[model samples]
Target: MRRSGATLDFDVDTTSGHPLYIPNGDLLTANKWHHVVFTWDGNVTGTNAKWYVNGVNKTLANIAGSGSRTSDSGYSPYIGALCSGCYFNGQIDEVRIYNRALSAEEIKRLYLLGN
Candidate 1:
């Protein structure tokens, strides 16, 4: 997912041939900092993925299709933006990527730390 200005974008492509795309919405306030966290279990089902904005879980009502969440050899993680475009306009700090999925409590702690 990526954000441009206040608009947020979400996308998912499963080898099932059907891809999932979420509607664009305001995920950030102008000139204000926000804490955002995204997580996925690498599970085959999309149900295990999550989006956390300011420590609260956001709904993913638009998600559809089914496929493994296992890492794809074609894609690598990008911290501030997508490969083609949708570059972020603000500062990104203390970015972290983990090999293991973090628990809810750990997410909360990290969010609280503002790191």
Candidate 2:
């Protein structure tokens, strides 16, 4: 994902296939900080993945596929942005990754903690 002026770009993906790129819309405002959390459980129905912004659930409705991320991806996860020369133009703080997906309440708690 990326930040462009007042909008936040979003893309959902799994271990395989093309990424599900979501168009820029609500869930973000300009000149403010937001707590963003992405949770994916890999199920096709009944909440397979979610996107939370500022402790509110803002996951898009039309998720394309059964987004399943593999346990191991060979390369290590990189914070801030991707490695292939795609740099983030905005600031990032308190980034975290877990071996398992976090629940909504847990994400909200972390958001309230601010790190």
Candidate 3:
């Protein structure tokens, strides 16, 4: 995930080709703490992507491209950036990735736990 201006760019590379990209604007306040959760069931059909902000589902459905989500974990994940130009202009504290998509209740628990 990369913050492009006030919105976020969620990109997940797929095994069958094409990367999934989701965009949501003004989802975060500068210099403030926010809990964002993105869930995908590995099947992209221009939908089925959910964005939970602060424990509530924001209903983001603008997924670009299509394919099965990648299962390879050989590549290293970068926090603030994937390259020079595309970089998150804020601080990132902790990040967690799961094997499967988490439920709404589980995501809420995480937000509540942090608070």
Candidate 4:
């Protein structure tokens, strides 16, 4: 996650690699409430990855890299901030991780529940 003034660039790292990187611009703003969802099924390519904001599918955005993910980084996921110097400008509510990719319906329900 990177925030500069009014620009916010979000990235959803996949075990396969860095298949998710939302460019800096309109998809995400500087200050606002949002619910982000990223899903990638097992052994999938970058094109198969999916991400959403507020239940709206944003997977249409450009996703870099290709090929299947054979393994995940041994490191644990660090959200909101990649490191001490890279703290997210805003706040985060909650984060949940599942062993399997959630269906679109499930993601939408989560968004509805938040609202």
Q: Evaluate all candidate structures by whole-model CA lDDT and list the values in order.
A: 0.66, 0.61, 0.74, 0.64
| lDDT assessment of candidate 3 | 0.74
lDDT tens per residue, model 3, 49-106: 7888899887564666655666647866766676566678778877999998999999
Is candidate 1 or 4 superior in TM-score? 1
lDDT of 4 by residue, 1-115 (tens): 5544543444444554665455324666656788887776643344556667888776444556555554446655667666567777678888898888888899999999998
Candidate 2 stretches greater than 4 Å from native: 1-16, 21-24, 43-47, 66-72, 76-83
Per-model TM against the reference: 0.72, 0.66, 0.79, 0.70
What is candidate 1's lDDT per residue for 1-115, written digit by digit as tens?
6775675555555667534434335677878787777777655355676777777767655556576444467887655677657577788876778887777788888888875
Which number leads on lDDT?
Answer: 3
Between candidates 1 and 3, which one is better according to TM-score?
3
Model 4 stretches with alpha carbons more than 4 Å out: 1-17, 23-25, 42-44, 66-74
The C-alpha RMSD in Å for every predicted model, in order, reads: 3.1, 3.7, 2.5, 3.6
* Model 3, backbone clash pairs (residues 3+ apart or across chains), number: 0
**Which stretches in model 3 have alpha-carbon errors above 4 Å?**
14-18, 67-74
Instruction: In model 2, state the lDDT of residue 105.
Output: 89
Candidate 3 accuracy as TM-score: 0.79
